[model samples]
Target: MSKKQWPSWGHGEQAQQHYLVEPRALAGGGDVRHVHAFLRACGWRDKTQRGGPLALQSPDRTVRIEYQPAGMPGGWTIQGAAAPGRDAWWAHLGAQTPVEIVAGFTDALTQPRAAHAPNVWAPLREQRWRRPPETEHVTATSPDGSAWVQYRPSAGGGAMWWSGAQDRQGNGWVAQFTPSTPLHLVEAFTAALASPEPVMRPLGHVPHSARLRTTSVSVLPSQLGAWQQARITAARAATWASTAPRNARPRSTAARHHAPTGGARARH
Candidate 1:
């Protein structure tokens, strides 16, 4: 995604600049490599962290994304197993989340876009979610109150995690996920990563700007047909979704995976 610097410090930042709005639905299934490629192709940098298993980038001032899996094995791990033989998991499911995601990161604009004037401009300005953080990570509580998770860039670029609040005050509340939650999120992302589609909005209706189909790109036929086929192959062993949902449920994807598959039969 295009570099999103902190809102420019100066005025008259209303410079006309071109930013890429990468179709988010195309990047999914723990396919960080592919997502990075897609963003770079569009002139965005894949700002992945050191050990994160997922890939993410700022395509433009319009948005930033945390390339994540739908279902990670452990759901969400508090303390990594390697950190002295400890393991704990939290089950986050069916929790309501706002549509526009808060993008608390910026910088790394090796390929700078032309800002029109002295006005400071940042990429990914398409969103309004705020509460910026001074650090690289941010913690958000699951609506169910069952879990308190951290949303931060991955180590090498794949997934994210945090220690439970109940476990620690502020110490273990944040960190990358380990083997603990990998499989759980893998399943969740595999299920959620799909083509763009219309969706129900907070107003009890579909917004004119909303895409009704699947949103994650990883689940799209253009990329993960075989991967999904394999997922179906191991469907029996797979469990339910993780806390932070990647996309809609199976019924949701089937309904919007393009050609009228599962769910209702009214073709779009």
Candidate 2:
């Protein structure tokens, strides 16, 4: 069997720059997108093609890891921010899995670069290791019974909402929002359902009415009776069908808006 060729180990140009080059092959040649997502999930921003050279920079922009892959040694250099300057910490990825590669890179960051570890890995590990959010799903209907929206808890800290209003053309919009977003925005979104004409807003960035400066309230799915649950589902379907031009009808004045169990109640 042939032995793996590793990169040379030595100190970087700067006197204070620490360097460790080890041979570590990936289990399967590393998947760049997977690595990028994992890093992004950890709070590392992709600075590729952003001035200077292409690289992934830490949130503070002090540390950088250029995406330069070398086939000879089966690894790449990891540059970290140091007090005096940046240090090059190279690894031979040919011998290690992607996980091990990141572990080693993180472990090698000590002393001058110690702060970088927590600044990067702590958030990364917290996101990757922590238990995912437990979501309680529910549906919200508009006051006129002409529009409805489904709210579901997202992986991170936010809510994903989908308009239950389908036009005669069978089109609608889906939106993901952060907790900080104003509730009025959502109300405005569902309100579009009753428009005499089809809502022309793009689904990707649905426009909302003027921003409400009030603090956004939490929306939770409440326990519901079997009868109420069935009615809610039926209403959502009915509203979707009513979007057709031929089916348009007068809005009911007795319509009541339904808020998910844990959501804030509207005050008269």
Candidate 3:
């Protein structure tokens, strides 16, 4: 299938539409639509009921994803089981966590292959996060000490093995990756956490407690509308491609019949 392209705005216009907002002011559930689209592309089935949280299950029924728009403390949860009667691995992202960061985890989850021994802390270290030497467990903290990530190799007693927090005592958010959770997913999440790109949030949606610490520029309504339309278009395209008849071909391709009669193809 041909890849679907998302819409883009001029750099100057896009820059004008959005201002940097602290991660703490991030609103949850914003990425739910994109997450649903990708999972559907991968053959996951929606099983949500009326008035319930959005829920989807893997084709094999071994994994599930859920998002509760009204659930503040934990709005997003994903769990996987290797077999029946076995313990499940789970991950949680709080409501305030940025969707852009959460996308990192979901994107990795949908990849075809698992990463080999990914170093989750390397990305944070490269971003100048500090880690004390000789610690029993791996840990890294942001420069301003408002955020931190940790991994506990010995967490076998039902404790979370991988965890992160932003403004823990304030109106920020938290995420937890259980011991059985894939390291690659954790790496992706951390990589996004360390990214310098700022997230966009509405000024009114910014939590009152975080208003003092957060700063944001106004985003034009038209820009937001354009972005929403683009997202819908991409999702519809993916759905159509995934559900199309197996033997069907694009009309443009079907109409092509001439064999190449030109000189040597362009060099790679």
Candidate 4:
């Protein structure tokens, strides 16, 4: 590349837009927008913008990089692009690595410009590195009518889900819950009704309500009892249905005064 002396502004200068940095040298203030566009293209956010030919000053030190703005009289000389007095080459320097000459006074700063890294972020790698755990296979209906599932590869016990399915480290399961959702027909039968005879099919009515929500329900071959079937149907239907209210006429317009068509009035 070639070195640039203190030069004036050039063409293609506009406002509130992004521009690109050509591989060659920049002429003036228009290069600032181009520099921003380039950094954004490379996935760098939280950038800093500087304008005019002031000495490169970072009182806050929060600035990761610096550049000039568009449409101003003083263009730039990045790494000191087209700076007023001093040579721009001072920016192209580093302890070892070199700063890229974006424009006159313009530069794409790398490391050493930044001070240090944070502590909390030390544990996580830059990218997603490992996969999640697997699900175990110990799911069954509970005696108390609530769901009962065991997670596997666990040292006898692990985090459990209501849905009953689990693996050692993979995704989890989801179980149904209600004020009164039962796992077995026996639970519903006991809650809904009492009978002296043995239960052939699950006594469905024994449970008063299926406090839990259900999408659909059907009688199984094993659940061939009359009372159990009735309880299931009633629970499924007990949901609130949405409906719109009737449109009403305004109260002021509801009534009107009437005048007599044929008039005949006399007083005695």
Best by lDDT: 3
TM-scores, each model vs. reference: 0.21, 0.25, 0.68, 0.16
Candidate 4 local accuracy as lDDT?
0.24
The lDDT of each candidate is: 0.28, 0.33, 0.62, 0.24
Off by over 4 Å in 2: 1-26, 50-54, 70-74, 84-100, 103-268
Residue 18 of model 4 has an lDDT of: 16
| Pairwise TM-score winner, candidates 1 and 4 | 1
lDDT of 1 at 60: 36
Tens-digit per-residue lDDT, 1-268, candidate 3: 0111124434555433223444432333344565676567666799999988889997778788888866564578999886564467889887666677776787666554453688788788898989977777777877766667877665357656454554533656778888778678788888888765545545355444433243334444455555555544544555566568967746543332222111001111
Compute the lDDT of residue 65 as modeled in candidate 4: 46
How well is each residue in 22-61 modelled by candidate 4, as lDDT tens digits? 2101111121333443334333453343543322332233
Clashing pairs in 3: none
Task: Look at candidate 2 and tell me the lDDT of residue 57.
Answer: 66
Give the poorly placed runs of model 3, Cα more than 4 Å off. Answer: 1-18, 23-31, 37-43, 70-73, 83-87, 114-116, 134-136, 155-159, 209-222, 228-268
- Displacement of residue 78 (Cα, Å) in model 3 is 0.5
Number of the top candidate by TM-score? 3
